[model samples]
Target: MTGARPRNRKELLAAAAAGLFARDGFHNVGVGDVAAAGGVTASALYRHFQNKQDVLGHVLLTGVDELADRLRAAVSGLADDPGRRLDPLLLAAAEVSVERRELTALWRWQGRHMREADQKDLRTRVGSLLTDWLAGLRALRPGLDPGQTQLLCFATLSVFGSVGDHRATPGAGFAELLARLARAVVGVDLPTARPSSDQWRTRVAPPPSRREELLTAATRLFREHGFHAVSVDDIGAATGIAGPSVYRHFAGKSELLLAASRRMADRLTLGLEDALATATDPADALGRLARSYVDTVLRSDDLIAVYTTELANLPERDGRELRAMQRGYVAEWVRLLRSVSPGLDEAEARVVVHAALTIVNDIPRTARFADRPGLAAELTALTGAVLDAGATQP
Candidate 1:
């Protein structure tokens, strides 16, 4: 009997590596595992890739190339009118995000694993793509400076990046939601404001528990410096404790990271359940959920940041637990969305939920939107638009 045709080893390895890297993280997956996933020997994998880092560079840079290509296609028919191209460019971005889930995740989370030269090359290509986008944005919104345009571009892209974080099956409605949020992020004007006198007045509250203090300090340090770069000593220094004293409340730095991850996950999980319990209908439930999400994010931005960006440092068992909690929380949103729009399957609902979550996590990071009046309202409205878009026709 004739045997089945053999696969192209190079392409197969790339695909296998992308999935593994996206799931287990670049640092967590070994070369041998990638080769096995590709149904090849380690020697065969070596013949194709110089090393694991080479595979990583390919996975991430390929995604960037696809994005740049999509943007090029998006703007080709604009008749030399770059300003009018922003909308289509963003739409193209969302389309690619839907089409390439594992690659997108690698693009978002695995870049730091690349060598400096590879990172620079990727940055150059990405910068070129953004330069084209900025030209369009600048023409349309002359009041917005280059700095503001850059931040807005990132905020918009973050919505697409959410696809990598979950198993979301984005449809046309989900794409529309992403596009709408992208426009809002780039165009919304922040009102000028100052802190109230009450903010300036110092009122000391009771000291936190030692565990709370360590958790608080770790969250902040991890957010600013990343997990691997910040040491136990650094966390202790921030908390005004001896480096080894931290072991009294936690086992190690990984434990602190786990705590930070669990804190955000548990908070969202509980808050979402509470919100759902009190709502009159699907819409009300979603609205309450959105508001509560914004509150959790604003109050715990540092923790949220760590959980999303630094959980790769956690031990396998802890990571699995935190991820399960996160998935459970997301499932609640998926259920509520399904309730509101019976046409939406769990997959579509997941994409919309993640898109909304991305908007909340990202908009706050934009310096242009910082210290703006009605910050919470603005975030709620953007998130609501994503949810509402999914319910409406595409």
Candidate 2:
């Protein structure tokens, strides 16, 4: 029998590592596993990569490079027609997102595992891509201020990137669907009224004891730094306690992560229940849920960040349970969306829901707009537009 043609070992190894890291997370996957997946010995893998971190950096940076190149090709000749350029730009983004679904997960969650220098380089490259998009957006909407334009750019990227958040396979026209949703995001009329002082009030009470203090500190640390990067001593220092003293309140770092994640999950569940209880109709319920979600994110941004990005660091059982809760929450939104617009199929509703949620989840994390006046209102409006785009689609 004729043997298959040999492939480049380095490319094979990177591909294998990307899939494993995206699926199992960086901390969970070992170098030997990556080597096995690539059909190579550990020694052979070591010849190409310094370590697993090196593999991860290669995977993530390569993905970024590919995206930047795709985007460049997307708008090659449309420089003068910034308004018309957005369609092709969005389509190109959607195409790449579908082709490399693993990239979204790697870029968002796995980058934190990289060394400091690599992480900075990654951000700079990604920022350059954003800057190019921002210039297009500025020309497309000359009336909008810099802040508004940047926010829209971020939201548009989030819509395309949201694909990695779920596994639901939509039928034909998936890329076009994402493009349409992104177009809606680009056209959103952000609200301008500054939020009143009372609107900024947080519902979370101050830590009532040393244990609560430690949990609070841990959540912040984990959000700012990856869970693996932070130590029990760091959490203790934040709360003025010794490293060993933290054990009295929580079993270990893992327990602290679980507790913090549980707190976030519980708050989201409660918000969902409240939205359901008071809504008079399906549309009303969705609107309520959107506003409630924005409020929750604004009030507990750090915890929300930790809850979403640090799940892979949690104990396996806790991760599964929290993931189920997350699914239930998303399912409720899908149900309400379908009821509101029976025209949308199940797959379409799920995709649109993810897009809207991603807009809210991602836009606020951008430092420029995180504390902007009336941000919550703008996010709520943008989210509504995303959902409306789905409802009106043929």
Which candidate has the highest lDDT of all? 2
**TM-score against native, each model:** 0.78, 0.94
Compared with the true structure, model 2 gives a TM-score of 0.94
What does each candidate score in C-alpha RMSD? 4.5, 2.2
**Model 2 lDDT, residue 219, Cα:** 91
What residue pairs are clashing in model 2? Answer: none
User: Relative to the true structure, how large is the alpha-carbon lDDT of every model?
Assistant: 0.76, 0.86
Per-residue lDDT tens digits for candidate 1, residues 1-394, read: 3655366768788989998988877767899999999887898799889999999888777768877786777755443575567678777777777778678778777777787799999989888666666666666677875555555556567778888878655555666666765666666663333334224123576889999999999888877666766889998999888899999999998888887888888888878888989999988998999989987887676888888887667887887788777778888888888988998777777877887898788767556765555567667766776687766545
Give the runs in model 1 whose Cα sits over 4 Å from its true position. Answer: 1-14, 35-51, 76-87, 138-152, 170-210, 221-234, 237-242, 277-280, 309-321, 366-374
Query: Which 10-residue window in model 1 sums to the lowest lDDT?
Result: 192-201
Worst lDDT 10-window in candidate 2: 197-206
